[model samples]
Target: MGVHTTNGIQGVSVSDDARNASARRGKKGLLIGSGVGVVALAAAAYVGACYHYKDAIPEGTTVAGKSIGGMTSEQATRQVLTLKHPNASTKANVTAGDQSFDLAPASAWKPDAEKTLDGVTEFSLSPGRLLDQINGGGEKIEPVYSVDKTALTTLVKKAAESKIDGAPKQGRVKFIGGKVSIVDGAPGHGVDEKKVADAIASGWPKKTDYTTELVEKNSDASDNAVQAFAEGDAKKAMSAPLEVSANGQSVTLTPAQVSDVISSTTGSDGKPAIKVDTEALLTTVLSRGDKMRVPAVDAKVVWKDGQPSVVEGRSGKEIDESKVAKIVGDALVGDHKATLAMKEQKPAVMAKDVNVEALPSTSMAHFESPFPTGPSQQARIHNITTAINRLNGIVVQPGEQFSLLRALGYEFTKESGYVEAGTLQGGLHLDGMGGGVSQVSTTMYNTAFFAGVQLDEHTAHAVYISRYPMGREATIWNPGIDNKWTNDTGKPILIKAHVESNKVVMDFYGTKKYDVATRTSGKYNIQSPKHRTVKNVKGCENTVGGGVPGFDVDVYRELKSGSTTVRTEKIHTKYKPDDIITCQN
Candidate 1:
C-alpha cells in the first residue's frame, strides 16, 4: 500500500526497471495534487459567491426592481430578481402575493412618490413555490410589460368591496304586542359603486376592518354636536312615557314621565314618542358591545280564568287602545304608509284555579254545559273540560309550536277508571287516558282551522264520529300519534275551551281582520274490507266486524271577505276500516 517518492535526486542513474518505476511514481503524485488543488479552488469560489450576494440589496429593500449596493448593475439586477417572493393572496381572494411594490423605470434611479411607474408594477407570487424555483435557477426579474394593475385591481375590488356590509345584519329586538322579534339590522348605505372602482385604482384606505357596535346617541361626540342644532327640545323626546289601561284601571303619564320613557328607547335619530317596546330595548341593551338602559314605568296584568297574572317590569306596558287604533289609521291615511305597530299583550301568568269549577266564573262561563253524572260519562266530560282549560289563556306566539301533550300534562288516563268505551271497529272507542280526548282534539282542530292557523300534524280517526263536523276531527294515540300546529298568522293566538251539561264547546280568540268559516264535504274512500276481532275480557264482549272499504273525506275552511272566498284549504282524511273476521268463543 505504501509507495514513497524521495524529493529531487532520490534514485539517479538506476537500472532500466528502476528508472521506469520512478517515472510512474512521479506521474501518480502529480495527478493527485492537481485534483486536490482543483477541489480547493472550487470551495473558495463558492464561499466568495455567497458573500457577494449575502446583503446584495439589503434585507428590507423590495427586490423586484431595487438595486444592490455592493455589485455592478448586471450583478445587482440579477441578484435582486433571483430571490423568492411571498404569496399574499388567498384562495378566496385568489392566490397571489399581497405586498405591492413600486419599481423605478429602467432609466430612472428612484421611484416617483406620486406617480405609478410607467413601465413597471409589482405583482404577487407564491413564496414557498417561487423560492424553490429561484434556488433552482428560475427566471430572474419576471417581466411586467403585459401586466395591468388597473384592470387587476378593479377585478379584485369588485369581489372585496363591502362584501359583508351588503348582506343584511340580523339582530333580536322586543317588538310590539309583547313578542321577541328577529329582524334585519339597518343596512349600510350601499357602497359608492363608482367610488369603489376609483379607490381600487388609487389604493385609498389600504387596510379596513368591519364590525358592529352599540351606538349611544348621548355618549358619541358626533351625535352630541348634531343634537345641539336640532330644533325641538331634546328632553321632551327622551323622557316621555306612554299611557296604558287594563281591567277598568287607567294610568295616565305626566309630560315629565313621558320624557323619561322616551329617553330609554334606542334609535340614532333620537327616542320616539308614543309607544315603545321595552322587551326589545332590554334585549338590545343586554347584548354585548354597544348598549344603553332606560328606566321603565309601571305595567298592568290582564288575566283569564281567575289565574293571578304575571306582570313583567322588564317589558313596558301597552299603550291606550284607542290611541293605538287612531295612530294606526293615521299611519295608513295615505294610499300606503308604514304601520303604527301596537305593543298589546295578555297576562303572561293567567289567574290560578282554572279548573272546571273555575270555568263558571270567567267570561267563558256563558258557554259551559251542565255537569255529567255517570263515572264514564263524568270522565268524558272532565276530559273535555280539562282539554279545553289547557287551551285557555295559552298564548301561541306567531310561528311557535302548539303541542297537545305539552298543553295537557298527565291529568288523564284509562287505568284511572276512564272506561274503555266506544265500538270495536265502527264507533268512537276509548283505550286509556287519551280516550274520548279525540272529541276535544277534533273540536280544537276545527276551531284552529276556522281561525286559519298552520296545522302541523293531524290524523283522522279510525272511524268517524257524529258529534264532530264530518272529516274535521283529529285522532291521536299517546306516545305515538299527536296533533301539532303552529300559529303562522304573524300574530299570537289565544285558545279557550269549556264544557257544560252535555254540550262541550271550544273557542279561539285572536285579533280579527278576516272572516273565516269551515265545512266538511265528500265521503270516505272505502277501499278493501278491513276486519277486526276484539278479545273478550272482564266487563268486555268479543266482537268481530267485517272489513269495509277505505274512504277519503275532505274538510274545507274558506277564509272570506264578506261572501268571497279569500283563502281555502282542504283537510283531507283517509279512513281505513279494520279487517272483518268471524269471532268464536
Candidate 2:
C-alpha cells in the first residue's frame, strides 16, 4: 500500500510541472506577436512620412536665415528673391585725394533665385537629408549670388582718379637764368584698385559696409641726390670764365654761361652724373665763328661767245666743329681757355673741276624776251635779273623733271628779293610783288618747247602780250600756277639763264637726240573783249585796262630721231578776253 501511494504522488507532481512550463511558453508567444505588430506600425509611419514630403522641401531647412522648410520649390525661390537685407541699399563713401564717390552695394550685387531654389529642392530629395529631418536636425543652405564685375571696377577706377595723382616725377636738371639747378620730384598716391574690388566682392554679397585705403608710393629720385652729384661739378665748371677762339676771333663766356652748358643726368649705374653738353656750348662758339667766317663762293656759268664759261670760285674758312668741340670739352674739364682749330671749306663746284667735257656742250634750245627800257621799269628789270640769277646753274639729270616754282623756291615776297612791279590781275596791270617773274617763265617755256622735253603742266596768259611768242608762252602765280617739264632726252641737261639790258635769255645745253618741229593751228574762235564797269571798295586803285581779243589754238610737237618720227603730242590752249577793268572809288 505505501509504494503505490508514493508513485501516485510522483506522477501528480510531474503533471503539475508540465502544465506550468506550457503556460509560460504560451505567454512568451503572445508577447512576441504584439511586439511584431508594433514594429510594423512604426515602419508604416516612416514610409508615410517619406511619401508625404517626396515632392516637397523637408522640414527644418533654412536658407539665408529664412525658414524654407516644407515649402515647394517655387515658394522657396520667391522667399529667396524677396529676402530683405538691411545694409543692401546703404551707400559707402570712397575717398580719393580730395574727391569722394558714393557706392551702392545693393545695386552692384544681386541674389541668384534659381540657384537657391535648386539647392533647397536637391536637398529635399536626399535620403540622408530626409533622415536628418525626421531626426529633428535642420540644414542651413548657402545663398548664391551674382556680382557685376564691370560696374564694380568702374566705381573703383573713378574713386582712384579723383583721389590719386599721377606717378612721381624724377629729379632732373633745369637751366634757368643762366644757372644750373635741380628740380625735385615728389612722392605720389596710388590706389590699390584690385584690393578695393576684392573687398567689395567679398563683403557686398553679405550687405556689409567697408572702407578701402589707398597705397602710398615714394619717389626714388629727389633733390638731395641730384644736388649732391651736380653741385661740385657745377661750381668747378663755373669757377673761371671760358675763353673760346675760332677763326682768329675770340669770345669769353661768363661764369653763368659756363654753368648753362653743364647738365646733370643719371648714369648707367643709376646715379646722378655731370656732363658737358657740347651742342649747347657750341652755340656760343659758333656765334664767334660766324663773325669771322668767310663764305665760299660757288663757280658761276656765264655765256661767252654763245657758250658757257666757268667763273673762278673762291674757298672759305670755317671753324672745325669736331675739333672745337673737343677743345671746349677740355676747357670745361680742366683748361680755362680754348684756341679752336679752323678748316678750309671748298666750294661745291670748283672752277678747276669744271670744263667743257664735264658740261653739256651742245645747245638744244634758246628763247629770249625783250623788256621795256626806261627808268620806270628799273624795278621790273631788277626783279627779272634776280630771278634769272636764281635759275642760272640748274642742271637736270637724265629722266629728271624740272619745276620753275621749285627752282625759285616759290618765295615771291619782298624778303626773297622780289620788287614791286606791274603784275597781270583781272586783265589789268597792277603793282604787286614778283611782277616780272612771268618774263622768266615765258622764256623757259619756249626753251623747253624746242628742247623736245615732255611738258607736264603749263597755262597761257589771260591777255596776249606782244613781248612773248604768239602762241607759245606761259605765266606763273605763286602756289597755284606752275610750269613743269621732264628731260626725256636720255642725257643730262644744263640750264643757262642771263639778263641783258633789254632782254632775258634762256638756253638749254644737252646732247641733241631729236629734231623737234612744231606746227600751230592759227588762232581761231576769236571773241571780242567785253566792256565792264567796276564798283571799287577799300584798297582799290583807279585804273583802266586795255582790251584784247580772246582766241583758241592747238600746237603740235613732232620728235624725229635721224629723220624717223618717234612720237607726236598735241597741246591745246584757250585764252579768255582781256576785259576793260575799271577800279574806282
Candidate 3:
C-alpha cells in the first residue's frame, strides 16, 4: 500500500506480494535486454566475416594440392601457370615410341580459371560454411586445365605413325604396277594416339614428359575379309582395264586410273561391298583428256584474217547418265567393256551469241610467256595447252568469283591428262606432275591484275622463275594454294586463252571498266642462295649457283576513271632463297 499526497510528493509503500512482482519484472527486463545485445553482436560478426571474404575464394582452398584460397583469380592463374614449380614448363619435351614429339605447339595448356572458380566457395553465412571459415576454410578445388585436344591428338598421331617398322597394314585394295592387289593385315601391338593424348590431357600443365609404349590394337580389317572382298568385287571390277565405248570410239581406263573413283565399305550382310562413284566417273569420262564422245563446243570469238569472227557452235553428244550406271555395272561383271548411250547436248553459248565486233572489240588486258627451248619442256607445253583449253571463252558474270583451280579441275595427275613436267619444288626444278600449268596460272594472274578485277586470293612461288614477271606472278598447288578473283565490274567478263607456236597468251576482254596503273617497288631483304648437298633428287648438272637470290617486293595497282582514283590494292610477294644444290651420290 502507498499513501497519496494532495499537494506535493507521496511516499510509496510496498507489500510483500507487490515487492515480489516488481522484482520479477525487473529481472525479466534485464535478461531480455542482455539477450538482444548478444544477438546484435552475432549479426555484426556474420556481416564482418562475409564482407571480409567477398570477391575472394574461401580460405584454405587448394588447387593441385597447393593452397590458393584468399587469392584473386589473376593471382590464382599465376600460381597455376607455375604448376607448383618454377621450371616445370621449361623442360617439357615429350616422346612416343622412338619418334620425338616435334610439332609446332598449336597452343599451350592454360588453367581453366573460370571453371576452377566455379568450384570455389563464395561468401556465405550458412552454419557449416561459417564454421569452416572460422577453422581456416576447407573447400578443396581440383585443378582444371584446357588445351586443344585435336592438335595434341594430331601431333601424337604423327609421331606414333612413324613407329611403322614391322607394323601391320590394314587390308585393302592396292594398285601396284597397274594391278589390283589385295593387301592383308593382322591384329598386333601399335601406338594409340588418342589414348596417349587423353592421358597427357589429364595431367596437362605439368612438368613431366611421357615415354609412351605400344598397346594392343584391334584388327581394323582381317586378311580373310580383304581376300574375300577381292574375290567378290575387285576380281571382276578392277582386275583389268575398263573399255568405255561411245560415239563408235573406245578408250581404255587402267585399274590405276579408275582407283580414285572407287570406294569400299562393308555391306549390310557383313561382306565387303564396292561402290562406284557414278558422278565422278561421268566427270572423268567427260574431261577433254579422256572424253569418249565429242562435247558441245560453245560459240566463241576468234581472229580470222586479222579480224574478229564469230565461230558457230555445234551440238554434240553427251553420255546419258540415266542409263550409263546400269550399263557400266552390268559390264563390270563380264568383259569390263560397255557402250555408253549418248544424247544431244546444246552449247552454253547459243548460235545467236553476243557479237564481239559490235561490243568491246579489243582485249582489255593481255599477258604471254615464251616457250622454253627443250624437248623435256614438251610435257609443260602440253599441260599448258590443256589448261588453256579448259579456261578459254569462259564468261564470268557480274559479282561472280572465278577460281583457276576449279576451271581447270585441278587434280594434276596422269589420269587427268597432266603428265610429268619441270616445276619448282623445294628450290629444285624436278619433274612434277602437271607442272607447266603454273605458267598458264602466272599468265592469267598478270592479265587479271591489269584488268582491274578484285584479287580474292593468290600465292607467290617459293622460288622465283625468271620467265615470269619479277614480283607480279603467282603459283598454285593442290587444293590449298590457288589463284582466285572476283569480277568487280558490273558487266560480264570474257576470258580467252590462245596457244601460239612460240608463246602462250591470255587475254581478258570486257567493257573497259577502269584503267589499272601498276607500280612495283624495288626488291628488299635480298638473301643470297645457300650451298646445299642433294641426295634424293637427280639430274642436276650445275654445282654453282643453281637458284637466284630471294627478295621481297610489293606491287601496287591503282584503278582510275580518267583522273579520279577509284581504289587501290597491294600485292606483296616474298620469294624464298634457293639452294645451290650439289648432288654427290
Candidate 4:
C-alpha cells in the first residue's frame, strides 16, 4: 500500500513541471513575433520616404538664396535660370587724370544661366540631398560666370594711354651769347594701367564708376630748385671785376665775362649744381697766344746725316682750366684778386722716357733704285727728294701703321712744290706733277718687305717698270691708291731715305726678326695686246706706245725665324695688257 501511494505523488509532480516549461516557450514566441512586426513597419516607412522624394529635390534644397525644395530637377533648373543676375547693358565709367573712358560691363563678364542650372542639378543628385531630406538642410548654389580677360585688359590700357605723358626731362646748363643760363626740367604725368585693370576685375559688376588720378613724377632739377642753386653763385660772379695773374702776366675778367661762364647744371648725382664754362672763359678772356699759355712741343726722332737723333721735348707752362676756374670763382666771391693756377703740360712723347736704346742700331733692310737721267728727271728727283726729307727720321713705334699718301698731301700742283714729270695714266706714260713719287713708293715697299713689316695696303702698278723689281713694286695715286705698312718688329723703327745721282735709296732700321724668301710662279694667263688707232696729227707716229703682254702671277713669301718657317703668305696679281696706240693724220 505505501509503495503505490509514493508513485502517485511523484507522477503528479512530473506533470506539473512539464506544464510550466511549455508556458515559458509560448511567452518567448509571442515576444519575438512582436519585435519582428516593429522592424517590418520601420523598413516600410523608409522605402516610402525614398519613393516620395526620388524625382524631387530634398525638402531643404536652396539655389542662389531661392528655395526649390520638393521640386523636380527640371523645376529647380528653371527656378535658378529665372534668378536675377548682372545686367548685360550696364555701363561703367573709368577715369584716369582728366580722361574718361566708358567701359561696357557686358564685354568683361557674362552670366551663364545654363551653367548655373547645371550646378543646381548636380547638387540635387549629390549624397548631401539624401542627408538634406533627413536633416532638413541643403547646399547654397552660386551663379557661374565667364570672363573675357583680354578685353578687360585692353579697355584698361586704352584709358591709361589717353592721359599719360612722357617721362620727365632733367635740368641742364646752357651757354648762349656770352651769357650763362639754366634750363629747367619739366615734370611728367602717367597713369597706372595695372591698378585700373585690377579694379575692373574685382569690382566691375558691383561698382559702375571708378575714378583714379594720374601719378606725377618730379624732375631731378626743377626751375625753382635750379634758380635757387645758381642765384648766389651768379650774383657773386657778376658782382665785380675778376683779376687773374700768372707768370708775370695779368688778365682782368670783367663782370660780364665772368657772368658768361657762370651757369647752373645738374650733376651726375641728380642734384642742382653750379658750374663754370672754362672754354668760354678761355676764349673770351685768355688768348691762346698769351705768355701764360705757351704751347707744348712733342719730342721727336730725326735723322741728321743718316743717323738717328732725339730732339728733346719742352714742357710749357699754362693756366690749368679747372684750377683757374675755381680760383677765379673764389676770387669773384671773396677777394676779387687771385693768382691763376699754373700747370706744366708735358709732351706725349718725352725724350728721356722714350726707349731710344731699343731702336734698331743697324739697318735690317735696304732698297735702292735708279731713275732715268735728264733735266726733267732732275726736276722729278727734286720733288722726290723733298718727299723723302719730309718722311726721313720718322719713328714708327711698335704696332704703328704708316700711310704714304697721307704723309704726302694729295695736291701735287706747283703750289705744293711739285714740278711736271713722267706719270702713268690709262697705261700711257705722260707728264704730270708728282710723277716720280712712284719711285719713292717702290723703294719703300721693297725695304719694308725685307724688314718683315706687315703690309696693310699696297697695289701693283698697271704696267711693270724695268727700274723696279719684277712683281714686287707698288705705285701710289692721290685720293685712291695708298701704300701702308705696320711696324711689327716689337721695337721702334727709324726710316732713312736719300736721293743721290738719279738713284733713290730707302732703308728701314729695325731689329731683324725673320728672313723672308720669295718664290714667283712664272707668269700665266697671258693675254695679247690690243691695237688702238688715234687720229691726232701733232706727234703722228705709228705705234706711239709699245704694247706689253698681260699675265697673272702668284708670289709666295715665306717668313722664317732662324731655321723654322713661321708663316707663308700668297700675293696674287693680275696685270692687264697695255694697248698699242697708232697715231695717223
For residues 1-585, could you state the per-residue lDDT of candidate 4 as single tens digits? 123347456433345567788789878988998898889897776666665566555554555444555445544554444444446667777766676666565666654657765533332334455567656565666767666676676666554444355645556555444354676677765455567767777886778888887777556576776676556555555657777677767788777666677665555456665466677766655442245455455455775576666887677676787786677667766877878777886543467645565666799998898888876477778778877875676666544566786455444657668887777777665677787888888888889888887777899898766677768889987645789886655356678788878788888887766798988889898998898776754433354456888888888888898899878878888888877877667
Q: What ranges in model 3 sit over 4 Å off?
A: 1-359, 538-546
**Candidate 3 worst ten-residue window by lDDT:** 84-93
Candidate 1 lDDT, 487-573, residue by residue in tens? 544333556566655766766555433467767776845677544444553233332454455677877777665777667777788
**Candidate 2 clashes between residue pairs 3 or more apart in a chain or in different chains:** 96-163, 97-163
Model 2 scores worst on lDDT over the 10 consecutive residues at: 1-10
Error of 3 at 563 (Å): 0.5
| Stretches of model 1 off by over 4 angstroms after superposition | 1-376, 410-430, 527-550, 561-566, 578-585
Pick the winner on TM-score between candidates 1 and 2.
2
lDDT of each: 0.42, 0.69, 0.69, 0.67
How do the candidates rank by lDDT, highest first? 2, 3, 4, 1
Candidate 4 lDDT for residue 125: 34
Error of 1 at 545 (Å): 9.9
Q: For residues 1-585, could you state the per-residue lDDT of candidate 2 as single tens digits?
A: 123347456433345567788789889988998899899998777667766656466565666644556455654664566544436657655555554455665555667878766644542345676675455355777776677776776676555555455644557666444566677866666556667777777766454445556567544445676777557555455667888877677789887776677666555454665556666666655544434455455565667677777777677776676776557756765777878777886654456545555787678998889989798898888889999997897666543457787566565767678988888776666787888899999999999999887677888888888688767889987655789886655455788889976999989998765689999899999998887666654333443455778898888889887779877878887888877666666
Model 2 segments more than 4 A misplaced: 1-357, 537-546
Measured over all alpha carbons after superposition, the RMSD of each candidate to the real structure, in angstroms, is 35.3, 37.3, 23.0, 36.0
The deviation in Å at residue 361 for candidate 2 is 2.1
> Residue-wise lDDT of candidate 3 within 1-585, one digit each (tens)?
878775687777789899999999999999999899999999998888876665465566666654555455544554455342222334334564664443333243556767766635466667666666555676666756567787777666555544445444555665444456776665655566677777666664453466667566644566687787787667777777888788777767877766766655544344555556777776666543344555565565666687766667777776787887778766766788978898996655543644564545478888888868578678888988888887877765444567787566546777778888877776776777888888888888999988887677888899777888888888887655789886645345688887998688988877656799989899999998888877766645344555688999888999898998977878788998876877766
Task: Give the deviation of candidate 2 from the true structure as CA RMSD.
Answer: 37.3
